[model samples]
Target chain A: DVKVTQSSRYLVKRTGEKVFLECVQDMDHENMFWYRQDPGLGLRLIYFSYDVKMKEKGDIPEGYSVSREKKERFSLILESASTNQTSMYLCASSGIRDGGYTFGSGTRLTVV
Target chain B: AQTVTQSQPEMSVQEAETVTLSCTYDTSENNYYLFWYKQPPSRQMILVIRQEAYKQQNATENRFSVNFQKAAKSFSLKISDSQLGDTAMYFCAFMKLISGYALNFGKGTSLLVTP
Candidate 1:
């Protein structure tokens, strides 16, 4: 079975603090994605990497950045955390076929 | 640009009954993919079913099936023999089969299964 693991399941941080959310996939998938989910808004893509050292901005990428130093790992970084950024963050990985994505359990973040 | 829409914000079904959730999308790409994902209280997103736009046949996974209307750009999910575990937030998503593209998701429909 394919596995996607997130570094943290729950996190709390103060405003203006820098935060990092890590994701690792064991499937050796070529594509990795980060999305923020909220009520009524669904999951909005923040950033995605098609390959190591390659990244693309999604619809809502402001205040967020991504890093992909290795094929199996992708990280989401919040330069300066704010209360409005508190939400559930999800990481996913996909292969070239059918666009099937295997997702992590998700990390619930709260910015105080 | 591609966009997915789920008209029903909430739905209910009694155990062992059948229920359909509506999803419509707009996309200019000829070849793409559509999917229905379930996010339970566990917060893990699981793929329920998927349909390829180029295929005329609808996709089904056991008790879960889809009604795909290519011309209408509509993709609806039908859950039969619903169980309590079927309760979750169902999201319809669209993805272009191209590089540098990500899944565009709908607002989601919250389903509640009652005995």
Candidate 2:
């Protein structure tokens, strides 16, 4: 099975903290995505990267950034964690020609 | 931008019965894809089924099938012989032929299976 591993299953941070959420996929997928899931908001794309050193902003990119220094790893950064940023963050990856996405277990972040 | 809507926030079905979850989407693109994903209590998102817009026939997998009404912009999931393992949050999603194939997901319907 292709595994998408997240660094953490749960996280807590104080306001003004710089947060890092890491995701790694062993499937050698070319496309990786970060999504924020909340009640009533299903899942909103935060950012995505199609290749190394390549990234694109999704619908809600404010207060968030990403890095894809390596093909297997994609990282989501919170410049300054805020209470409103508290949500379940999901990491997903797919092959260039594949239609289905393989998702990580997800990390629930709580910002105080 | 495309939008997926799942009006049923919650649904329940008895074991061995059938249940349907509704979903609708809005988009101008003629060719696209729709999918159903299930997230169980374990929090892992699993692909349940997928349907291509150009295909007239609905997609099915084992006891899971879809009612794809392209004209109505509706893609619903019908689960037959409901099992407790089926209890989970089901999301309807839409994707265009874009480079990333990023999905536009609905709010999701929480389906609970009863004994």
Candidate 3:
């Protein structure tokens, strides 16, 4: 089955630490996205890539960066993790032809 | 920018009953798409149903259906004969080509199914 796979399901990070969250899609989709999900805030887009090495900032792009080195892998990076960044992170991919997105199971990160 | 609203933060319904989840969005675009996504305790988000603004007919998937009113910008989901497995956090999202297909989601409604 076509899949968007996140590297971690749950993560605990210390404040001020640099964190990396990885996502890989086997579907060869052209668009990849990272979103931060929180209670009452829904899902806020952090970054999205439409092509390899091409990234665009979403509404809540602050404190986050993304890298797309290959067609199937997109990585989200936290330059300096902070307590406020604690939330569930989701990764998704989609093809241009079909706007439907395939989401990964999500990564719940707890920053302390 | 589009904004989605889910006023009902929590809802409960007994098994075999019918329940509706309301979603409203604000957008000036004439052509777009609205979607309902379900996220159970497992945290795997699944697309429950979707409706294209241009289509006057509502979209349905088995026991799930949508009431899409383009004039009011309302997209409500109705679940018939609710089951225990239907309990989950339901999110309403809006998408448009102008926004690069990035979904604008509302604060989800937490639904519980009881016996």
Order of all candidates by TM-score, from best down to worst? 2, 1, 3
Q: Residue B13 in candidate 3 has what lDDT?
A: 100
Q: Top DockQ: which candidate number? A: 2
The candidate maximizing lDDT is 2
* lDDT value, candidate 3, whole model: 0.94
Q: Which ten residues in a row have the lowest lDDT in candidate 1 chain A?
A: A93-102
Q: On a 0 to 100 scale, what is the lDDT of residue B115 in model 3?
A: 97
Candidate 3 residues lying further than 4 Å off, grouped into runs, are: none
lDDT of each: 0.95, 0.96, 0.94
Q: What's the C-alpha lDDT at position B91 in model 1?
A: 98
TM-scores of chain A, one for each prediction: 0.98, 0.99, 0.99
Q: What is the TM-score of each predicted model, taking all chains together? A: 0.98, 0.98, 0.98
Better of 1 and 3 by DockQ: 1
Model 3, span A1-112: residue lDDT tens: 8899999999999999999999999998989999999998899999999899989899999999999999999999999999999999999998884768999999999999
Question: Which pairs clash in model 1?
Answer: none
- Candidate 2 docking band: high
Sliding window of 10 residues with minimal summed lDDT for model 2 chain B: B95-104
Which lDDT value does model 1 have at A42?
Answer: 94
Q: DockQ each candidate and list the results.
A: 0.77, 0.82, 0.67
Q: Model 1 fnat? A: 0.76
